[model samples]
Target chain A: MKKVLLSTLLVSLLAACAGQDVKDQPQAAVEDRAAAQTQAGADAKPTGQQSVTANPLKDPSNILSKRSVYYDLDKSDVKAEYKPMVEAHSKYLTSHKDAKVAVQGNTDERGSHEYNIALGNRRADSVKNMMNVYGVPNSQIETVSFGEEKPRATCHDESCWKENRRSDIVYQGE
Target chain B: MIFRKLLVGAAWLLLAPLAHAALTIEIVGSGANQIPISVVPFAGENALPQGITAVIAADLQRSGLFKIVDPAGVRPEPHELAEVNYPDWRTRGADALAVGSALPRSDGKLEVRFRLLDAVKQAQLDAYSYVIDRAQTRATAHKIADLIYEKLTGDVGVFSTRIAYIVKSRSHYELQVADADGYGAQTVLASKEPIISPSWSPNGAKLAYVSFERKKPIIYVQSLVSSQRQVLAQFKGNNSAPAWSPDGKQLAIVLTKDGSSQIYLINADGSGVKRLSYSSGIDTEPSFSPDGAAIIFTSDRGGSPQIYRMSVSGSGAQRLTFEGNYNVSPRFSPDGKSFTFIQRVSGSSFHVALQDLASGQMQVLTDTRMDEAPSFAPNGKMLLYATEIGGRGVLAAVSSDGRVKQRLSTQAGDVREPEWGPLLKN
Candidate 1:
């Protein structure tokens, strides 16, 4: 449980600049994983499966680890930079026939809630469409828009709003 | 073990009633032409559960239409029409006087007699008397206030109506139905998840709202009286934005089951679902017109979100709003000549705006930023909406002409998605 949460946090922190080679990228990445591990309060259990059979979805080096794609204000389109990441997930879905995913679309805390709901629905559908483009079967994907209900960040300014306009892909039973 | 269990059960029952009636109201922006009136303390009304004159006065004052002149030193509270001393009220600068009395009847019921008098003309304007049960005190007071408001303002009164809103605290979300005055709130549904888009049935008996209790939006219709609820829509994907048609037999709901958040019409019993909109882009927030012949909804088919009108027969839709790139939540007035919607003035500042259908004139009703869920009072005299004040979500009502304003909020939690229920029929 601790490793999974730490990996999720690490992936979210790297969503914006995952492939970049910044001077402090590896150091900050290690620090965030360490902090999240301490908060989870559990250490590695020396499982031999972590070496050759680690879940690719949780491996920080893999693009599949990044689940969220942030959008512009009131926008539902997956940006050009995020397309490679979304296509990677779509390829994963196509390969894993039994894996089902729900794309949860979210929005910033602005505009009418009902309109935002529709906007978020479009966002989720956009991801589903991208998956369909990669030959992912319709039965493997579903969409739900949380609108502005579940925010990644709570502050009312643009800093938080920018982080909140997002769509997250979740595999079932994970 | 049974004794301890019974004590905990009793404690929960004791605290249940305390959780209700938390919504309080504050009136601001007085009417430019407020009528001066004095509502005297009703004789024997102090013995009842609710203050008759106080409720009446509050209802009138909250509208920003009437001022309650203090009757502190009026000698001998008037109980009958003959004893109302109009000249004394005229000297107190009151143009009208409301007097009443409540007494126990022979069969242990209560009898309430009320009268409205014109101070300048020195004549009784309206009189009403009712034999009611103790449970009907507050409603009867609101009815009397409604009668007084109608007699003076020449418009129907909505004081006897109810409003439904979602209250979000840290622990859970509660859908509450309260009096129009924000009193006597009763929770209709509570869940650990979100509840939104509360739509009142045309007859005012049921509320059709979307709840995210099962990790997805599903439409449900719950009886305000019996508390019995059933799912109206639970399709393959998200089913949300339930709206009642004027006839009450069918509902217009938005569904993503077919993809792209299209609008659909379904029986109120959750059967006979038929697709109503087929736009390529997102189309949602469906609101029915007063005559049920048309539906006004938000659609992005024309490249941006705007209000559009379509025939209920699933015909082609015509866009209705052209002023803003973002216009949604279109609610028709009771008379159907105009609609109230949320218009994004610019980046992030959304205001409640009204548009007349005949002439393309639009009127913005509020200066408050972040306004949503605008529902007209049954009479179309006021628009009740959800807005953020000091970063706390609260319910607010703006007069149709944007002259008067008031706020209703709970001591704890954020309130949003307010839908004012209709003036119920007996």
Candidate 2:
């Protein structure tokens, strides 16, 4: 029972730092896994393993799986660390022109409802603009701002506010 | 961002009241001077449908301006001019005394008579009577309290006004209307989708709000009398933030149909649609001045959301607020001298602020971390808004001068988006 409590506490502590580390740790782990898979010879693959091969969109070991891009308070500017994730999604969209994506803008619950909607729109549009610069057409991207209607964290302090101010990339049929 | 996908299916729960409970107003603070008033038990009150004197006492007590003396069984209940006991109330430290009675009429109605007396002078101040049906006893009690409050304070009382707000419990969202004291709550509309921005019409007959029932936000104007609603604006994309014009002839709404969210003017019956604002960024939350000459709204054209004013025709657009990096939801006072909105300084939270339009001076009214959607009382005595308390949404009110404060909360669920309706015309 004591070990269970300690593990739970440690997991929550790590989850508390997940927002900052989300930009770095997940992509790094994905890269290491991809390199290990390449080091193993392709001819040694077992039978019926083709069905288990991960699709990049649904794969937990790909950068495309990381969707959220965090921002500063009341800011719509995407950070430099999130550029690789956004670039990966842009590349996927450019290769798969038939695919469509929706970018949702969000903000912390700080100001008026309408103002947050505008802020959310700006955040979503910022992601769309970056995708466009990386060769994704406007026709393939739809942007909407949920404002502060949905919150990632229902807290009133800075730690929760930082988690709420973000733009998310959602693919078709997601 | 990943939370958005998870909230899609889990957000809308089965639409039902978590509990059929009435909102109770909690007086968090009060003014320094409290008027001492004694309300002796009304004679023959038990025979009536509702307690007459108890309603009157509660109406006065909730205003945060009057203090009700218990009387403690020391004073006898009196109903007429012949029953006189002025010295009893005077010695009990009551500045004023009220005595009343409820008598049944032959037509199955009730007549309530009340007399206000000056305890020290031992003279009657005023006397009146109201003939009402059994169902109108609560309203009559509020009217009598309004009369007494005006007679003492020389200011129009808001006890007779009504309030409309949105209450959310889990996945169920309800738009509720209640008395100014947070009693007699009636759910006007309920749906599985989110409902927001309840704005009252000029005469308090209808409310224009945005609902997301159809998978997208659409504005609807609902009548309180019939429980019937009309789709005012269901444009191509994102119709929201409906504000009624002063004359009740038009509505200033925000629509993203024109590629970006901009203010538009349409007839109250959803006709003669015309675009009112032409901004590159978002322009929304359009509120009219009391006289209806100009409209005030929040716009991000200046890089950050700020309050901007423009004529009814959408020309002469000028920014009104410049104190902070963030300001939105500007609502003009009834007299059109000042306006209130949410202002964010160099901090992590937003506070409700009052700004004088003539002098461009501002005063922060609340100390809470997050406050929004301020609606002024019809009499211009107080302003109601939504704020967070222990992670739950609740409604709060403060006097226009920022002296007295009160919290109106429910037993369960999150109560928010409070709009104080205008005093209905007789």
Candidate 3:
């Protein structure tokens, strides 16, 4: 019985890890496709090695790649590293007319849950507004606040807090 | 020398019995009243784990303001706000009703959703959903109680908060953290010997507790998030009563490095150690004033454990509690205008008492047996403490006006030394 239980636990852990890997695949593809597009543009100017046409869906995984956007302590200002991913997502939403996504914001368990919920909503709204400005249709975006209810990491200090202060882009059903 | 001083104090106690009577008035004048309300069982497809509805109902019932109707008392089952018959509830004299439900989420967690409804109008006043781990079902119940309380009374709920307490399990004493209602309790640190004075950080992320895990009672700051811990101070003789500053920057703790248990301020990262008290007698329980300017602590320099206020920079020491012969663990309210401390009468049991700084008036908050470790809610409208109810150590809460009182108990061992953290930001 103990052996069975241990194996069951191990299998669940592995499944969770696999799910995380699957979540990372889209973003990885996005970077690869963007790099390939840049390389193709550079090659056309050089030795003229058969000018390649841009394949927008060369990496369909890029659609799912951008998973999260992080914020500073008590501040919802989007960081520079997340700008490209956000713009890419915005462009994708603009292209895919029927696609809808929900931005869920979260916080570390530092303050009152109510206050954190409000702060998380503000963060989600900020991201939604940014996407709208980037040409993503407002109808395609929905904002929700999970406050500190959902945490990627549960440590007490800044290490865990940095990870918890994030807004996740969850794709709505087709 | 300590034994001799105890003997002298005992002699004074025996000779001056009438001298202590004046202090008794501080607690006896407060009157108690019962507030009536109804908490209907939350609707759920599957019966929630660990009787969440019952726990929340009991919490409201014990608050003295609420009169929870027995489960058999309501005739027709009121599952949702729409299903609640207002005439049926109003005839039963229920001012409000709380309805809730729990659903299993895709993440293997349970999402317990609740809505508080006004019984007369049958309208939803507050609604919330709690995503809880499988192991934390009981905590979710307490959170529900906190939610309903806040909605009805317009006060911040303390149910979702955790209490750090010292418990003697088996032959060993351990420092433990449990839900404020004393459920889902687990030992944070255990020792073969003794552990005393567990203080929660202002952010509720870490705990500063005195543990004898190092053979001596030393103060250690342990993070609740990572389970990482480090000894803050292990001085020669005594290291006890670690109180976190409001800003989470400094910790006011008791250290005997100066040959006495004097108050000292150390950075939360454990540097810039400075003494705040130069008293001759043992001074302990140094709680920071809400504004962090002064500390209200227990000192025996006045021949007994009298509450004294001393500046954080170690100047302008003044006596705050003159009436009480034994007053310890003085915690300032969030507004810093009022303070709560344990007052031990000569013959009667120790009671939790609140002191108004502006008027110098005192009121007894608890009539229970041996109440101690009073901590204030972030709103300063309520206080939580540990008291012996029916010979068992349990956590309890009393409203600011002493009109509402509630007892919180757990399924496990007896809990002692309850500490409340600041109001968490959502």
Candidate 4:
């Protein structure tokens, strides 16, 4: 009897998966095609020599790879320590006209939810202002504040709060 | 779906005293003068179908204006004022005494009568009677209590009012409503996603809140009686912070669809969409003044979060607070003379503060380390807000004069965003 019940459960689970494939299969195929086209483009570049066109955002050693900049409590000013990281991303955005980025501002969970929304937006705007001063076009950058809704840490302490208060730089289609 | 099951499992208790005590209210402060009163058990209670005297006593005790002297053993049951037992209650330090009786009718109804007496003068103060069924017994008790409270305190009692709040545990979030004294809690809506910002309609029939069920913040107006809800705002971007206008004809919401967060007004039926405020920085948390003349909100236009006021037509933009570097969540008092907001001092902690609109003078009310969402009671006598106690979120009430403080906490998890409902006509 136990074996019969187990088999029945396994068959039902497989049937559920088959039903899901009807809705998700086409999207998965489209994603696979896009991945294959990107691979083909990379292969078309000459081999045996270093490729001239390389996205710095994907380069491990480039400062543009650093995506997040931390801020102090209730403060939106970009800290001195994260200046180099912000500058590098600003330089990349100004040079690459097609590049578009979204600066998402966040805050620690210590205040009202809606107030944190405003504070988070200020932090994101601070980053966008710095990038604009560095010659990044206004159309290439967008700012949004998630407030304290999306916290990086769950611990209720200063160290965790420091990690949660940050602005993340996200590149388009990365 | 979870709420439907929980509602069935709630074991609706109409007459019996609450069995499951989810939140315990700890009175930390009290007024100086409390009128001492003794409420004797009602006679012929077999037909009452509910604890009439006990509910009345609990309602009076919750006001913090009356001290209850137990008459369980010290006094005898007297059905009328002519019984002449005022000497015994006076000796027990009770300035006033209440006696009542419930008689059964042949039509399966109850005739409840009560009399209030002045123990000092040995004279009758008031007497009333009502014919109600079993289902209306609890409401009758609350009504009797409100009458007694008004006769003594010269102010209407909020015993019959309702309170709405959000309760979150693990991944389950439920919007629960209870009596003003935090008893007889009933779930309004439950979901695995988060729920916040519960604003009651002026008529106390519906609620406006933010639900994240669709993986994005959406504003919903839900009816209190039935579980029916309507999507008031579901624009492309974030739609949050829904505040109902006093007339119940409009709602002020914060929407991010127009590039940045800004305040917008929509009809109660979700028809008209009109932008209200214009600012480069984030403009959100819009609260209407009591008279519906202007709106007070938080904006970062001046470098940091500060409270700003704008007319109903979005013209007379002016700053309201300059004492603190961080201020947000401004809610006007019921009389429109003052407002309350959360003010943070130099990154130390957040406190609830009240500012007079005319004088511009501010006074801090709470000493909690992290306080948010201060809402005024409908009577304008007390304020209800959310605070953290020992790393757990709890709801608390403090008098407007800053004299009385009480903590309302559940057994586990967090309870936040308490909005006191309006007084309904009985």
Candidate 5:
């Protein structure tokens, strides 16, 4: 009985994908949303930048592969340690016009839901602004705040919270 | 097809067996003055699926204002005024006596007649008769509880009202509307993505909430009856924190298209967007006053997030909280005399706190840590909020006086973002 119930829930979860039934506005066909495959495509060949794109971003040795910037509690400023990584990704995106990045911000559950949303927005915007300073176009970047909803770590203490309060630069189609 | 199936499944709660994940409520701490009341089982209620007296007694007990005088194996249950049971109830220390009967007629309607009497004085306090559909047996019992609540304490009861909250189980989220007692929950919207910040329209016909299904935060207003929804705000950047005006004609939403998270006002139909706050920092979580003349929101304009109030015309901005550096999510009471918000105590833990507007006095209502989304009941007597209990999320309630705490737990995953719906209109 439990297995049947689980299977029914799984089928319903798969069937009720967003926008197929719920969305009212006609979703624009502006950009491709195959973010899951963007990494594989971008890693095959060198995207125009010099050393950053010379190797696959999936390569453990490349700094361009480092896409996350962690923040302090209740803070949104991008830290100095992640500047080189941001600049490397910025160089790669600026060199390749079609290489879009969606900077997603997250937070610990310490703050209110909506407040974390606002704070996460600031965190993502802070990274996007840094990339723009490195000569990336504003049009090439999209920022979304998960706002403690999508946490990388689940523990209630600071050890997990330190990992949750951060932003990730996700390449389009990846 | 899943949405259709869900619609059918959600509709089953009206008359079918209770859902598997039904909520169980636990109460602690009684009100300052507890009135002992005896609720005799309605004479013909045994024939119905549920006894009306049980629901009424549970409602009154959950409020922490009344103590139940359990009548077990008592013969000749009082069904009318001439039952002459005041002496029996008075000896049992019951100050008030409630007697009623439910009789189903041939027309398929249940005639519910009830009376509340002063047991000590042996006088009739109030009597009511409601003929409703059979499916409304539980609802009518709640109405009777409300009637009895008003008659005895002079304060309105919130048993008959509904509350909307988000229940997150695994990767899926369900927006559910349930009775104020945490029973009879019906899923309004189910999704795999996160849905938060549900704000009910003034009349309780519609709900405005932020959905992240679009991969970005967007505001949508959905009708409770039709299950149809419209994108209220799909602007560039973060579009979230949708709050309805008291008149339901306009909505206060937070948008980032203007460079930062700032509050903006738009019509109910998603037209006429107007920015109301200008802060280089963050400004979100807009809550309207009961009169809809002003809005109180959380802003970091003073270098730390604090509650601030501004008029609807975008004038007369003033800071309201000076105690905590992290006070956020402010909601005004029904009477607008005070507001409830989450205040971080000593910069460590969060607790639901009430603030008085006239004297600027603040009192923490909940002892639990990590309390957020403090929504006042329609009567301004209790507050519903989200808190973490034993590492699992649950919904809790605390009376405005800081007494009468309750824990409303679901058998399944966490329930968060509980908003008490307005009193329903006939």
Candidate 6:
């Protein structure tokens, strides 16, 4: 009876070892094959495979609909939804020291041209300042004021005016 | 000899009808249709210069209300009103006709005499002669057009007014002044760098533009007559966006010496700098209302770019625009009933829009790709703004009703940032 119990324990141990080897096989293969597959769509293929293996990071449809921060009228505080965009931009600027960007400020055609230009400049400067605080060096950012010179819409209503007053970010140099 | 005798007899017979018809037509206002006018080319005596009649004709056409009969439609008859055959002009649809001749004056100037005759009524509407220097013959023609426009439309004519704008060339930029129709432009200031934001004084005697001289942006007020410039503002951070007050006694500008952009009122002589805005975010672009009681400006304290109205003393700050997400640049119309501004929509395109001050309703003025920098005409009947066409900036004017639109293209370079000054008598 003691000899029979020892043989049963050995058989159970071999079964447990075989199950552990199966689990370890895929991970070890991934590690070993990852280097050789660098030129074979490695990043894209792995990300796709990872999506199937785990939770997806993002929904593809939401990417096109995403917008930068939109502020209240006459305000510049970042909205909660735009925090990610700002953070991403900040992160990129922080990582790339040689990258330079420009922020162009604009206004709707309601006030005097002179006034609008100054207001636009201030808006651009506001964006530049925010970027600076986000670890972007002053030299890596530039600001210009288009004022009421460039409107994105032609409507004479409040709806169009709300869209005209904005600051746009443009990557100048990489 | 027989034709001369018959013409003499006809003139005598037409005198009575001319006198009676003048009283009837001049006293009543029944004609609302096109005046059916013809401006005859002035007879050039002594071979003085080029064609001046075409200039007058073009000026009237630019108004978009005048219907000038083709030169070939009406026959060139005698210069005298009595010599014109009323039936001949009536058949040609020429309700009114202008006949003029220029002669050398004894004072070495030019005497241009013109006569306007009513073809249908067989009467003389007006007859005047101007004594001007030979070089000012074109101006004389414009004056004639002005007179005729006033006689027909019963509104003041803007043919003789000028427009000031910034022109960007390949390597240089200039502040230019030109006729209202964008002809005969002369550069008032040319710099190797950028010259921007041209503003005209109330009296139209001077222009204020921001020049990037001395490696920094400075506001320079230059007299158009004397070509003299005075650096109005050159502060530590930036001294730009100079807006002349209505009374011409002071200028409203944005200065950044106090850590944030704020509106400041300074005397035209560069004295009495009074801060008007005190806010955490930027308060810039201050444009005074027509009545000078209030100012419309752009501020970002509320989180985004939007228009705000405040008293000149910096009180009663209230938000004006709420719709959309972006609105900036607020220019008050001369009548103070409406304002014009730029609005940006999706896809990063911009257009000019007008807002009724009382109703707060807005209307888009342009449908082009990028339309901006809208300013009111002196009469508030139209708006002038900058539009990019074929990658070149051109100045465009749109009627207040948005029906009549005109593109004012400069001879060279990109013309932008137009500022229409008030009518100057001189």
The local distance difference test score of each candidate is 0.80, 0.77, 0.66, 0.76, 0.81, 0.67
Worst 10 residues of 4 chain B by lDDT: B1-10
Provide fnat values for all models in the order shown.
0.62, 0.40, 0.00, 0.38, 0.60, 0.22
TM-score of chain B of 5: 0.92
Clashing pairs in 1: none
Clash count of each predicted structure: 0, 0, 12, 0, 5, 48
Model 2 error, position B215 (Å): 3.5
Alpha-carbon runs more than 4 Å astray in model 1: A1-52, B1-30
Best by TM-score: 5
Compute the lDDT for candidate 1: 0.80
Candidate 4 has a TM-score of: 0.78
- Candidate number that wins on TM-score, 1 or 6: 1
Cα RMSD for candidates in order: 10.9, 12.2, 25.6, 10.3, 9.8, 19.1
lDDT of 5 by residue, A1-174 (tens): 355346446645543542132222112111212332243334424455446545545544445555667788888887666666677688778778888988988889886999999999999999999988988889999998889887666788887888778887777655
TM-score of chain B of 2: 0.89
| iRMSD computed for candidate 1 | 5.8
TM-score of chain A of 4: 0.69
DockQ of predicted model 3: 0.01
Docking class of 3: incorrect
Best by lDDT: 5
Report lDDT (Cα) of residue A145, candidate 5.
88
Pairwise DockQ winner, candidates 1 and 6: 1
Candidate 4 Cα errors over 4 Å, as ranges: A1-65, A78-103, A125-144, A169-174, B1-30, B44-50
lDDT of each residue in B1-426, candidate 1, tens digit only: 111221211111111122222212122333776788999999899888778899999999988888889988888767677787877888888888888788887887888787777777776776667777777788788877887777777677888889999999974789999999899999998776678999999989999999876667889999987888888999977888999999999999988887789999999999999999988888898888899999999988999889999999879799889997889899999999999999999888999999999997999999999899999998898899999999999999999889888887754789999999987654
lDDT of 2 by residue, A41-148 (tens): 332222223345665655555566677887887788877767667777787787777889888788887777666776787798889889999888989988777787
- Ten consecutive residues with minimal summed lDDT in candidate 2 chain B? B1-10
Please tell me what DockQ candidate 5 reaches. 0.33
Q: Mark the regions of model 2 whose C-alpha exceeds 4 Å error after superposition.
A: A1-55, A94-97, A134-137, B1-33, B120-123
Query: How far does residue B239 in candidate 3 sit from its true spot (Å)?
Result: 1.8
lDDT of 2 by residue, B168-193 (tens): 88767899999888889999987655
lDDT of candidate 5 at residue B32, scale 0 to 100: 76
